[model samples]
Target chain A: SQTIHQWPATLVQPVGSPLSLECTVEGTSNPNLYWYRQAAGRGLQLLFYSVGIGQISSEVPQNLSASRPQDRQFILSSKKLLLSDSGFYLCAWSRGNTNTEAFFGQGTRLTVV
Target chain B: AQTVTQSQPEMSVQEAETVTLSCTYDTSESDYYLFWYKQPPSRQMILVIRQEAYKQQNATENRFSVNFQKAAKSFSLKISDSQLGDAAMYFCALGETSGSRLTFGEGTQLTVNP
Candidate 1:
């Protein structure tokens, strides 16, 4: 069975600080990874998705960026965080095939103060 | 671009009763997929059911089932004998045939009353 691990489970960051969230998947190779953010009382918003290493696609333009450094490792980073950047971030992985469903991690809750 | 809609912001059902959550989607592509995801208080997104565009039969998983109307572009979920554990935020999602990304609706919060 495949599992996705995301950390830190929760974080409190001051405004204008940098941000880094990591997601790693075990037991799967060459999986499609995605980054999503959900604001309080809002729906999930797609931030970025990577089909392979070094390939990232941005769905919405914002301060956050995503990178796939390794086949099973994906990182979401920001040089400087904004107050609006605070939300619950989720990492998901899916088999490259079309019929496979996406599996989600526990998610990281970031509070920017 | 494909879009998903869940008009019901919230719904309530009595325990052991049946409740249906409505979902509608707009897509130009004839071949696509529709999914219902459950987000409990724990905030983990779990796949409840999925329907393929080409399939006419609805998808069912234990107590959960989907009503897939390809021509009407409507996909609804029916929970039979609802349980307290069924209370959660349900989201309707649409995924295109060519992309891995899924477009989700605003979600409907379902509460099971005793």
Candidate 2:
């Protein structure tokens, strides 16, 4: 069975501060990793997705960036945060095949003050 | 381009009753999959039910089932004997077999009344 782990379930960060949210999947290899953000009372928006290590695709332009350092390790980062950046961030992984059913992790609630 | 539409922004149902959530999708591909994911307050997406485009029979899982209309481009989720735990955000998604990418709808907030 594969499991996804996301850190800092909740965060209160000041404006202009840096942000780092990590997500890792165990028991899966070469999986497709994805980053999604959901605003208050809104659906999850696809932010970034990576098919392989060192490859990332941005769906919407914003202050954040995603990186896949290892095969199963994905990180969402921002150098300087904006107030609008506050939202629920989600990490998901798929088997990277034709029939893709993504499994999600417990999202990170980020509040920028 | 594939698009999913969950027109009802919110819906409510009484406990022990039936509730049907509507979903419509547009896709050019013939082979595909549709799914219903439940997101509770915890924010993790739980797969409620899934339907394959080619299947004529609806998919069911205990209290949950799907009415998959391939010709109509519709896949609706029906929850029977609803419970309080069923209150959550329901997202309808379409998966294209060629790309394996899922396109999600805006979601419907289902409130189960006790």
Candidate 3:
């Protein structure tokens, strides 16, 4: 079975601070990875997706960035966080091929004050 | 660019009753996929059902099923004998044939009344 793990289930960051969220997948290799953010009572917003290591596509321009440092390890980072950056961050993995359902991680909730 | 639409912002159903959430999408590609995801209070995005564009038969999983109308570009989810745990926000998503990215709808919150 495939599973995804995300760290710092919850975080409280001050404005203008650096941000780093990690997501790792097990039981799968070369899977597609994606980063999404959801505000309270809002829909999931696609931030970035990666097909392979060092390859990423940004869907919406924002204060966040994503990286695939390893085959199953994805990281979301920001040099400086903004108030608008506060939201629930989710990591998802798919079979790389199209038309495949995506599996999501536990998710990280970031609160900026 | 493909777009997903969930016309219903919220819906309510009695326990043990059947409820259907509506979803529609717009896409120019002949080959694509539609999906319904459930987000409970915990906020975990769980796949409920999926429908392939080329398939004629709708997809079903246990108590959940989807009505896939390829020509109408409509994909609706039906939950039979709704349970208390079924109270959550449902989202409709669209994925293109060439990309792995998914475009999500605004979501419809389903409330199960006792």
Candidate 4:
């Protein structure tokens, strides 16, 4: 059974927040990890994806960045946050090969005050 | 770049009735995959159904089914016997055969009326 873990289900940070959101997968090795953001009542936007350790491909360039420290661990970070940065963040993983079925975590709802 | 479009921003269906959500995509790749995801108010997204471009047969999961038109670049989801639990934001996504990155549409919100 594969499971994904994301911390701080809900978070509140100031306008200039240095953010660090962690996502880790269990029961799987060398899986593809991704970070996505969804606004209020809006669709999801892919932020970043990692195929392997230290290999991150950014989809959207913004005030955020992603890094893959371990095979199944992905982290989303920001040096500072803007009001527009407040949204629902999701972490997902899939088999790296041609298997495209994705498994998503519960998600993190961040509010910038 | 590949893109997906959902014409209806929102829709409503009576319980026990059927509803169809339209989704069209633009892609030059002949090998790809289509998917439908459901997101409740809780905001957790779950895969509803998937269709492979190579397969002509429609995919179904209980009350959920898809009409995949390869030539027209269209993939629509049909939900039968709609239930309260079926009320959620539905998203149409496309994944290229060579890569696993998914391109998602804006989404269509479905409301189940009792």
Candidate 5:
């Protein structure tokens, strides 16, 4: 069984503060990882995805960036946060290149103050 | 680029009744997959059902099923004998067979009434 862990279930950060959200997967190797953000009452939008370590593909231009430091460790970071950056962020992983089903974490609810 | 559309922003159904949520998608790929995910108040996304583009037969899983019309590029989810637990946000997603990326719809908030 594979599990994804996302930390700081709820975060309150001041504007211009640095931010880092981490996600990790267990029981799988070389899995595909993705980061998605959902605004209040809005659908989720894909922010970044990584197929392997040190490789990331961003779907949108925004105030955030993602990195895959380890095989199963992914981090979302921002140098300076903005009020508009607050939202619910989710981390997901798919088994392999051919697996269509993705498993998601509990998600992080960040509130920028 | 692939896009998914869920026309209904909200829907309601009586308990034990049947409700269908509509979904349509635009994609240039010939091989792909469609999925319906349920997100309850807890907000944990769970995969309800999935359909492959090359499959002709509709996919069903217990009370949840999908009507996949590949030619029309439409996929709808039908929930039979709806229960209170069914009340949640349902999302339609499109996945390419060659890639692991998924495109999600706007989502439909389903409210099951007793």
Candidate 6:
């Protein structure tokens, strides 16, 4: 079975602080990875997606960035977090080159205080 | 770009009743995939059902089914004999044939009254 792990599950960071959210997948290799953010009472917005290590596509221009350090390891980072950066972040993966449904992680709820 | 729309922001159903949540999408690509995802208070996304645009027959899974209208570009989810546990935020998403990423719609919050 394939599973995704994301942490720290919940976070509270001060404005202008650095931020890093990690997501890793187990039981799969070379899967397509994605990062999405959902604002309060709003729909999800695609942040970044990676087909392989070091290959990233940004869907929106914002105050954040994503990196794939390993085949299954994806990191979302920001040099200086802003108040508008707070939201629910989700990590998802799908089978490479297949039109399969995506499996999502537990999601991180970050509150910028 | 592909976009999905869920007109209803919230819907409620009594226990054991059937309720259909509506979803419509616009896409330029002929071949694609549509999906319904459930997000409980825990906020973990669970795939409820999926339909391939090339398939003509509607897809069903036990109590959950999808009414796939490819020509109309509409895909709606029907929940029969709804349960209290079914209460969650339902999201409709669209995926391209390349299978890179998904475009989600504004979610519909389903409330099941016990």
Every candidate's CA RMSD: 0.8, 1.2, 0.8, 0.9, 0.7, 0.7
Q: Rank candidates, DockQ, best first.
A: 6, 3, 5, 4, 1, 2
Candidate 3 stretches greater than 4 Å from native: none
**Per-residue alpha-carbon lDDT of candidate 3 for residues A39-100, written as tens digits (9 for 90 to 100):** 88888899999999999999999888889989999999999999999999999999976558
Better of 2 and 6 by lDDT: 6
Which whole-number lDDT from 0 to 100 does residue A112 have in model 1? 94
How far out, in Å, is residue A7 in model 6? 0.8
As a whole number from 0 to 100, the lDDT of residue A50 in candidate 6 is: 94
Cα lDDT of model 5 by residue, B1-114, tens digit: 999999999999999999999999999999998999999988888999999898999999999999998989999999999999999999999999777799999999999999
For model 2, the superposed segments whose C-alpha errors exceed 4 Å read: none
- List, in the given order, the native-contact fraction of each candidate: 0.37, 0.50, 0.65, 0.48, 0.50, 0.83
Q: For model 2, how does the per-residue alpha-carbon lDDT over B1-114 read when each residue is reduced to its tens digit?
A: 889999999999999999999999999999998999999988889988888887899999999999898999989999999999999999998987887467889999999988
Distance from true location, Cα of A32 in model 6, Å: 0.4
Docking class for candidate 1: medium
Would candidate 2 be rated incorrect, acceptable, medium or high by CAPRI criteria?
A: medium
Give candidate 4 misplaced runs (Cα > 4 Å).
none
Residue A111 in model 2: shift from native, Å? 1.0
Q: What docking grade applies to model 5?
A: medium
Error of 2 at A49 (Å): 0.8
* Candidate 1 C-alpha lDDT tens digits along B1-114: 888889999999999999999999999988888889999998999999888899899999999999998889999999999999999999998888788888889999999999
* Of 2 and 6, the candidate ranking higher by TM-score: 6
DockQ of each: 0.65, 0.64, 0.77, 0.70, 0.72, 0.83
The digit string of per-residue lDDT tens for model 1 on A27-100 reads 98899999999987667888999999999999999999999999999999999999989999999998876745
Report the candidate with higher lDDT, 1 versus 4.
4
Q: Which parts of model 1 have CA positions greater than 4 angstroms off? A: none
Model 5 per-residue lDDT tens digits across residues A9-89: 999999999999999999999999999999876678999999999999999999999999999999999999999999999
The clash count of every prediction, one per candidate, is 0, 0, 0, 0, 0, 0
